[model samples]
Target: MSKIFEVPLYPYQRCADQDQATPVRHKVVVVGAGPVGLALAIDLAMQDVPVVVIDENDKVSWGSRAICFAKRPLEILDRLGCGDPMVDKGVVWNLGKVYFDERQVFGFNLLPEEGHKRPAFINLQQYYMEQYLVDRVRQLQAEGKPIELRGGNKVVEVTQDDERAELTISTPDGPYRVQADFAIACDGAASPIRTMMGLDFVGRVFEDNFLIADVVMEAKFPTERWFWFDPPFNRGQSALLHKQPDNVWRIDFQLGWDIDRAEELKPENIDRRLKAMLGDDISYELEWSSIYTFQCRRMDKFHQGRVIFAGDAAHQVSPFGARGANSGLQDTDNLAWKLKLVIDGKAPVTLLDSYDAERVHGADENILNSSRSTDFITPKSEISRIFRDAVLDLSERYEATRPMVNSGRLSVPCTYDGSPLNGDDCALMPARTRPGSPMVDAPVPGGWLLDRTGFGFQLMTIDENAPEALDVDGIEVKRLALTTPGDADGYLKQRYLGDANSAVYLVRPDQHVAARWDHYDEAAVKAALLKAIGR
Candidate 1:
């Protein structure tokens, strides 16, 4: 086996320095500077780790791509020092309205006041998000950080051994070879690195194609999300209306599998659909439009030796639940901390394997959830449509079943149950909040309450009676006084727990709970930390 650490760059050399004749080598080389790749670069650079991110595109694409941003992703961007600007420019939506035909069936307030904090969702275009990331990368570069963004450069080949991975790239100047301790592929669904390595991207592709159009309209629509079932334009079709930042609306229409992609993408067809959906009296201009076939697939493995995969390279989900980009960001969040530990020599090589295990788990869960949501929204057969319509119709009478009928659970954060990072005895309990869990609002002492700060790891210990007994290095621990009526009762009820003030919750960097203990014990805290960091 090859050694784990190696110095690929020379002592007197600089990386991709425009004036240097010698090729540049970095500590890590990330292929594809999309959102996921850019995020990974920013996080690593903030930790003083050297990274080179290469993208084939000359600039960010301002297409009608991803527009919905979840709360978790917003928090991740905030930690990278870009979230405030993003939130400032983007719109925050808490309610989503679901419609059947022309009537509204149910409306849900996503950010219901559980204990504290706003809803877990936001709306922002992919292009704007990328622009913000690019600005941050440039700022870091100006500050002499060891992170580089090489535009108009494509990775042609990747060869990895045990210690390092070498990338051969085709740039404007000529072909060049760059070596790094690790290579991360964030190169979308058609990842060249993943194909070159012969990894399996396993899942089924849907038959229906979707037409997404971004337009600036004159009419005022409600800020809430609107999903129309069985819209009139195309019978048995579904349409989605979402408000963008500047009076722009994102509309998606489900086109049957038989339609020709090239002909249907013409300006006439797009304009016709828009007119039918938003009346001819409304004045609007088309900004961007595209037709794409959705897929529900994930790479069998996220890692192969020194080369790893993130974002669409590892998984692809239907756009119904907006899981594709959100899950990609989650992948970066999980891998960033682990890579930091390994680069700082604070952990072993075996710790890196957990990235594959943990991220793959998230990717699979995202795929499953997205696929299920897509099936419900766009039923394939007549029988499925009939059953779905029946449920929507029946939901009108059954007031108690409205929540389940309009299941928005897809937007919920994913959890890791079977990973070696979780507690061994966590399965024995029936509590709703457990180790390796996603963070949710809960009550605490002094009526102050306890909620995730949307930053790094948070350790909440309810044992205010004995706060001195539990302490851990490199981890932030908060002691909450478990007193008062709302303190213990509200916390337990919010987390759906019958009992109160019995445990400590350890949350990960991504706002997911890592481990929980019923009693304040040092051994349990240490084990939870070790399992959480994959020690």
Candidate 2:
């Protein structure tokens, strides 16, 4: 995994900017070509926005770093034109079993419903996800979309003004400069751009470290997440097991706060831990091993002047919920459309503030959940540990106590309950599909509902037909009309229409329900549309 992924996926090439006497200007310049940055660039390019992505290294991530991608992120990737390949090359799972001291406590089904297009989660190597994104970037470039991936082009320095941001890039030849109307930092947790900007990133830090080992072996474990709290193997501490592609399994062993960082990562020590968990009969080769410590934290403001942050750069959560990359993808989904509308002058510049408002709400939600999960997983005191174990015990025998258990509180899509962009809502409508919620996927007449709802502001009518289109103050909104006859599965009605026989919904470009009504009305739609775009 290391050697193959280390090979440059986007090797450096000299650009015209290097020869130019002055810095060349671009619409958007993205830093750090990780999954988040690449996804953002692909999104902007798909919208015909010129975006250049620069990274210090021209390679994918070395290890299977963020393997559990939830359904919401997969949906976001679908919109970016690369979801199919990711699912095709990944391991899918929905059911997860929790264990307490070798006893099966409880199990969960993340997506028990039938109509969703994506699975509850997919376990693909982070490198593979990044490769798919890079491939998408190349395909867009070949299609003549305004996107560029410049590997080995390091952003050495960045300075922003009210109008634009100027970045100095260090390339193989020398240093060159590029000016951008918007600069987005997608660098990892230790964001260099954040440091350079001198922004304060505040939150709780964890001293405890976990040993991650990706091993290859043929095993018969079910395609399910298995989490153990004080199993006989790794007795006092906790352990986790997940299956990835290529017969690879990810194992995590909680190493307490005080430990020798170097000695624990040694091959012999890692092998010993693996043997203790999985008996010696199962022969496995350690593919990759590393020690990681995570904390719950985020930037005070995702958008600071002309510069913005997304993904790990903007917020970081203890990986238990798989929120880091997943939330980052949502950040791009939320921001890209607003940027497009603002840049085209269709929406006021103030619309960008909603990005901060909405995503900050999202970040805070993730941080809160993540903090609770961390405390539950790694108890701070002996009394806390006793209470946790007792809860696990009760959960195994009684269904009522199962909800009290928190095995990393796996990631779920964020719903902006009080977003400023949110408009009208109907008390009769299903609360799940209310304003500021991601549209629940359902099977339609042609294909999936999400697939039918393309990337743009759309008016969705269920159990009733809407006009072919609506022009709300020069904003073009297409329509997707589905009927009761087409709702053969009843999911469309159950998920969206609720008790209402007919409904009309105004969907934002990101597929979030902006405003929904019992029936379509021009005046109401116009006001909601204008409010949604910060007019």
Candidate 3:
């Protein structure tokens, strides 16, 4: 017999003893062991940066909080050495259908392209995501990567100056003070660091409420997103249905603001609601349920002097788009490389400032899309509802109107259109693989292009016979030639090049395109490298 796959909750050990004499200074201290903080720690550890993560809880998230993991985040997880397990254990989904009352309106496919390594989205419980990240961190620690996690340790106070930041952590045993050259506040939406620094998270708080429930049932349901406006059983309200692993299902029913929360959560009331949605004959067991009202908000800046913020601490959007955790993981992806370069003294401290600029831009984009989805689900006025119904009715026949029915514009990686670090573009180059966009995947020898591009700067070129002896500090060069094993399909040439033969692309450590050129220039490459690293 084999032991079942159960998420382990490690016990909290006393770390306050180490701070008794002289404070042990660390290179980077991460507060909060949530998905964002853990992923960031893993990324920095892979880059050989010492990291200590402190969290107030010893267990994974209590419920199935964030279930949808998008492709961009899965790619980031792949770079962190844990993507395969997630994909193996998750329920992959790409297509979603929208319905108005009882009629099907329109549908969309998230990843319509081929030859990609990962799927459009994977619905794994948030607990499983955290468990996998913690396991990866432990594996890296066994190999001496200098990653430390202290659960049940909460930060009581945070103070920072230009040189360093100090955190006062309280545990069951006692309290201790730890100092670090730089600290990241991943402590969640009600962040102590954000409050201590007097930063305001400015955005709109939606008036509508939603009831989310997780159920265990042995039923055959299509593994696709199904959303309905004014569903038949749950009259005059919207409902959503999705499938997850472990014979579990997630359902969300829209509830207006004026309902009594205490009465709605009663077992009898919840049973009646579940029976209506799942039907009278379907047998199911309730796993967990919760009520929530979301807000679309973020701190104006992610970094404040020596203390940086990521995840729910820096920004949060409505749960409709699945952007909450996906965007947060992207935050760590953008920050880890820059922070490592800054710590290694290879780049100026100003490089960290770009993390602030780029991630804040990403946060704003998520908030905008979340707001639009909320408005469509719960129309503000009678006129707005009339317009929304008209569009849904038209979407059934016309392909053009399908774009207007917003059942949460699913999460996609945001392109940094006007980023300060973007370099000049070549007119002849393909637009999809241009500067400031995430690198498009193409077939490569043995695997994919992204497999070779890890957590470091890479210079990619399609020129077969490029020079082999060019030396640049901290930057790896990969050449995709026609003679390579996987280039037989010509995907590298067709997707990256239209009619041109070859081009040089300066790719950042985060796998985003920094710059591209028709021909390589030593002087131009060095300048773009410097600009990319924030010289």
Candidate 4:
């Protein structure tokens, strides 16, 4: 394990709010200081929203949890002003190979196309990510931004009324009351806030379990994801291998439903398994080891009155597809803007309902995919196992059947297809970049396209006639005029404009397309803007 976890990033200290006459009031109070909480706080603070964050621990996590971060989350970190360090410290890879018993079935490339700013995926430890985010929070504080990080503060109770939410946090000195106009619970999967509020996740709990072991060693393994099905080392089971920043390698071994978890997690037992896979002569040290079960579940609604839930507090999924943290970041992305608008009084409170609508839609999609991946991985019945093996056998031979092998259908950005915030869509334009879809990245003149469209509503004009700016009521819509699509590496034309010659897009604060048209229309753009914010 790295010494980074030993150092406290946000050590607790006595704040003046604790000695106030009454409960100190705040604009927003976040319950957890995990990645989702910190990222959401940063996003809100970046938009000039005053935020207060509280967590029990002040350091990075112990184990290398959630090692694979997908491209969408990396882009989100980029917007949050912390992407460069994460990408620099991460191990980038795009290829993954699968095995059936002793035979190498086939290999697949995740990102075949180029011109996008970020890659398909990067293998980074969760601790490094949290460290960088904490550093960003400190930088924002240095810039005089309204953001506070308090460690050793545990939430003892939670209560909420119509106008605001209240929390009692226990500190080293004593407990004190804090009030917020709105509260966000990025607590965790086993959220104490969710429990105090009488909320629970509703979905499927898979029957199989996997043992996660992070081992440190010097080896010549290539930087890529490797999975094995019924391999010679761990027969009748599955295994996964991934590379991280340090010499640590994360390995997950499928240890069936019924087993002695305590016995399996023993260091000697874990070392035995590693020897089986990497040969007996190799020297390695077990850095971390734990057994985790699969769960595909979520709360029915992300928000209850004034308090909103984001990240693992709102949803949980199997880790096979790298969807857990990635989707949580997307939750923060879908939420911060909507919540900011409501607090600014520029939009109706009902705009927050769109956050619940769009993100719930996203959660359901991730749950569905995660459940399918789990089912494919650990079949319930013998006949199911036979069918799975046959598919793997056929996958090794036929190109069409290769896709049938489900080694975790990887994490991808979700499009809120029927979201209420979505507006007009043109059949003449491209489908990938249509309304309710995430704005695809492309090479622009200076750097990248996503660098310009974040934390604010903007209009992207591609060979289309649109004004430099427009004001719909009090909401200002800035324009990203790209008169020359040819200056871009033709990706803008292919991703945004397929059959249409000219295109205009209404992009939300989170960079999702609210609406698009073949050509710019003043009245249509205004109407779409109104609907996109739930007018």
**How well is each residue in 226-320 modelled by candidate 2, as lDDT tens digits?**
99999888878899999999999999999989999999989999989999999999999998888888689899999987899999998999888
Worst ten in a row by lDDT for model 1: 1-10
1 versus 4: better TM-score goes to: 4
Candidate 1 collision pairs: 436-514
Query: Alpha-carbon error at 410 in model 4, in Å?
Result: 0.6
TM-score of 4: 0.99
lDDT of 4 at 427: 90
List candidate 3 segments past 4 Å from native: 1-8, 16-19, 473-486
Ordered list by TM-score, greatest first = 4, 2, 3, 1
| Model 3 TM-score, all chains together | 0.96
lDDT of each: 0.73, 0.90, 0.86, 0.91
Worst 10 residues of 2 by lDDT: 1-10
TM-score of each: 0.87, 0.98, 0.96, 0.99
Q: For candidate 3, write residues 308-395 as lDDT tens digits.
A: 9999999989899899999999999999999998898888899888898899999999999999999998899999999999998999
Q: Give the range of the ten consecutive residues with the poorest summed lDDT in model 4.
A: 483-492
